[model samples]
Target chain A: MPDDNNPIPHWQRQDLPPMLSRRFEFETYSETRRFLDGVAELAEAAQHYPNLSFGKTYVSVTLDADGKKVGPDLVALAQQIDSLVAGTP
Target chain B: MPDDNNPIPHWQRQDLPPMLSRRFEFETYSETRRFLDGVAELAEAAQHYPNLSFGKTYVSVTLDADGKKVGPDLVALAQQIDSLVAGTP
Candidate 1:
């Protein structure tokens, strides 16, 4: 059964040399689609992409490279995504 | 510092809705290179690639998708790579 949070079901994490992975999500289909495009742009710009898999109601990404800006990309988006999924932010 | 096993240095683990990560390593330049190409092929075939970073002496991969086969690709290569790195296989 797929839900809004676990888009990449049957996924497993691996220690990527020096990289870590965090999953992100959104509330609605529109929000999820927006996030997909925005993140794809960011990854293309930074030359860093994640293990991305999406559904109509949800989206997720797993980090696997040298995340360039922890402060700007990872920290900001993680918090934002967390809030959306949890209904707090 | 950077050894063979921990290639992607600043990595952290996140709860991927339903994902887990395990690291794999290899020894020697040629061996590492072979493993890289082979794994890349598997990723391409399975449509599931790992977070890859390389060095002169080692290679590593992090899983982030529904691993095609716990019995075939993932299991076979993971064990082979590990044995090569640990000097046991």
Candidate 2:
């Protein structure tokens, strides 16, 4: 069941791999690069790094669970990542 | 036929999408981040951006062809990327 009030609704949850992932699209490579840089800084500050893949206009981010289940910390991290482009134009 | 003297022998050529791709592994996330920055600089300088995907210790890069085949320019770009880690400890 999907939560209607999920803070990071765009992110998909995986069970077998115990991961949460999302793909963000941008209007240009510059925007994509900016988002990536923001994620890097956030990861550095939180000490929680995620797998990131990007092309000219999109970035795919995967957050792995340290334990068997996706915990609150991971969810909070995802919310922070979502905030990177939350109100951007 | 494989070119024994190919400058970017590590990069694999794909026909369907007309792309040249390669994966580079690093000893640490810091090294991976450095290589990624170098690639970004090279792409900006050459105006030829490649698809980049990375985790904590590896980066996968893909260069797409503008036409039917991977051209010399793409090969040159791959060579430059390879140089970013060549002969380094």
* DockQ leader: 2
Chain B TM-score of predicted candidate 2 relative to the true chain B: 0.90
lDDT of 1 by residue, A1-89 (tens): 55666432333434434333544545665575566557545555555545454543445566654634333454444444344445432
Q: What is the DockQ of candidate 1?
A: 0.03
Question: Candidate 1 chain A — worst ten consecutive residues by lDDT sum?
Answer: A7-16
TM-score of chain A, cand. 2: 0.90
Alpha carbon deviation, residue A21, candidate 1 (Å): 2.4
| Candidate 1 residue spans exceeding 4 A from truth | A1-17, A66-88, B1-89
Give the clash count for each candidate. Answer: 14, 0
Candidate 2, residues A12-44: lDDT per residue as tens digits?
999887999999999987998899999998888
Docking class of 1: incorrect
Off by over 4 Å in 2: none
